[model samples]
Each structure stands twice: as structure tokens, then as C-alpha cells.
Target: MPTIVHEFDWPDRIVVGTVGQPGARTFYLQVRGGRRVVSAALEKEQSAILAEKIDEILDELMAGEGNPFSIQATTPVELVDNEPLEMPVDEQFRTGAIGLGWDPATAQVVIEAYPLVVVDEADIELSEDGDGVEAIVVEPEEMLLVRMPVGTARAFAKRTREIVGAGRPLCPRCGDPMDPEGHDCVFPEA
Candidate 1:
């Protein structure tokens, strides 16, 4: 199948948001502008990793020989998600591999996400689909590509980090995430 690429060279608004409860939350990356909008769903881990990588890229740029990371504008440094999802909230795909890079000439950061394919051992035990005739098939993979200014990329990284950390707090005892009700931590302290 041909690869489906969604490109947003300079989106008016690009943001990451989570829906549902903390532990069961769903992460979405949305870009809006030019009569087009794309939203991709991804695991929380992927989101966190993406944010970390972006941060690393910025750090490297800042430490470059002459510091070539000077793509700044009047855009707000903080992330604002006031804009609602571009209706329907249709997820393009479940992100598998994420890629990022900096274009010096354009001073823009390129972000890419590939669809993920999941396998299950229980599939071998299944006889047929609910129709009792056709079998389940994997969905075609799609990729999302977005190019934005360095400053905007920085804001995205910061906001992503914040969102990922905004989940349940750590239980100082077991070094695990704590629930609101309580935890069954055996070792309350070391």
C-alpha cells in the first residue's frame, strides 16, 4: 500500500492533548490550518519519548558551534489548547515509530509518526470474525508529518513534558505512580 502522509508545513495551531482519565488516558497530536486538520493517537510512552527527543535536539542546537537555533517569533512560548478538535475527532492511526529532525536552512523542525501494528497470540485460537466468514485484517498504516518553527517546537516539547508528568504522582515509597484513593505499597519507605 502506498504511504499516506499528512503534512503541515506551518500550522496555525498544533497541540497535544489527552482525553479520558489519567491511567486510561488517550494521547492525541493535532494540527490545524489551511482547511486541514490531522489528529493521531499514540501511547503515553511515545508522547513522553517524543518530547524528550525534541528537547535533546534543541539542547544540541543551542550547543552547536555558532548556535544555529535562532528561529524565533512573536508566537507565545506557552502552549494553549483552547481550540477544540477539528470535529469528529477521527484518529488517523496508532503511532508506532516517531521521527524528528531539524532543517537548518528552513529553521523548522520536522516531526513524523508511523502507524503501529499490534500482534496477539490469541489470534491463533480465533476461528473467524463475528460474521463467521471473513477474518480480521490489519489496517493500512499511515504517517503524519508536521514542520514547524524551532520556537514552536520548543513550546511543544515543554507542553508535552508537562502533560506527561501531570499524571498520578509518584509514591515515594515504591517509586510507583500513586492513585487518588490509595496504594497498596508494601514498603512505604526505604
Candidate 2:
């Protein structure tokens, strides 16, 4: 678990912090240059929980009523992937905060830690030849296949499904999901 300071303005300060085990998540908050900030990210559906924990930890941090710092391993939080990470609420908002370029407010705000950065394997899709993307999968950074037996494969698939879900739609042209179909897109599909 890394030490973090909430980057929020006045009255806001370091609230809580968490670290993840293998395939888990890490969270934290801190204060630097007189700003409070929260730092974390879950699949998407887990934002609220992380936000809640940040609030809770803020309460605890304020208990001392001085330069504050509070840290703890969160109670397994369910992430948007529908899998439980030993952190607080499953927060997918972490990605929204970071990936979507949603910066912490410079004025009146909440603060906490979020983990959005990850070293992911290259993703492979079925391409334009498949039936609406037979599958979208991720393997280790440079690996080509899973080296597991049937039973392990089943278990892994189950867990992955629990984590990745059916899969989120993407922008056909930009290769990102900015809007659903039927809606106008800045970058139209060719």
C-alpha cells in the first residue's frame, strides 16, 4: 500500500488507504500542498463503494483534527467486474476518474486513492471476420494462450466472466466506448 494524500482543497485531507494482493486492488489518500484527494479505480460499478470508504476514512482522519493520515486494508470491495477485491466497495469509477480524465475538483471536493494504472497483456479480438466478436480476451503481456488444464480453465473463465462481464461496448471507429449505437459519434465509423 502506497501512502497517498487527498488533493482536494481546504478542510479535505488524507482519509484512508488500502493495498491489494495478487490480482487485487490498492487504494489510498493523502495531503500535499494543502489539497485533499482520493485515489482508486474499480471496474466501473465499484466507484460508490470507494467513495464511501473515502468518506468513512475522512471521518476517522478528522478525528485527530490535525495534519492527518489514515490507512487500512479495506473490507473486500466488490468491483464492477462483479468480483470482490479486498478493498472497499467495488468501484469501477476509478477508471472514470483517471481514464476519462476526470480530475479531482480544485474547489470544494472529496478525496481518496484509486488504482487505474495496470500492466495489461495485449488484447486480441476476433477481428472483422468473426461473428460480432466471438471473443475479446487478454493474455499476459506477450503470451499467446493459457497453459491450464480443463478444470483450471473453467475456474479461470468463471472468474474472468465474474470480473470482465459480457464486455463493454466500444466506439466502432475510435475503438473506445464513447457512446452506444444509434447515437451520433464525433468519430463516425467508416
- Which parts of model 2 are misplaced by more than 4 Å? 1-150, 158-165, 179-186
lDDT of 2 by residue, 1-190 (tens): 3333333333222222334432243432222233222333334344334444433443453465552333222322331122233333343234323211112222112323334435434535443444564654332222111122212222322343333333445557766544333545677656
Q: How many backbone clashes does candidate 1 have?
A: 0
Best by TM-score: 1
Model 1 lDDT tens row, 60-138? 7777777755634323636444444466777878788788998787888899887886767554333476677855565
Which lDDT values do the candidates have, in the order given?
0.77, 0.33
For each candidate in turn, the TM-score is 0.79, 0.20
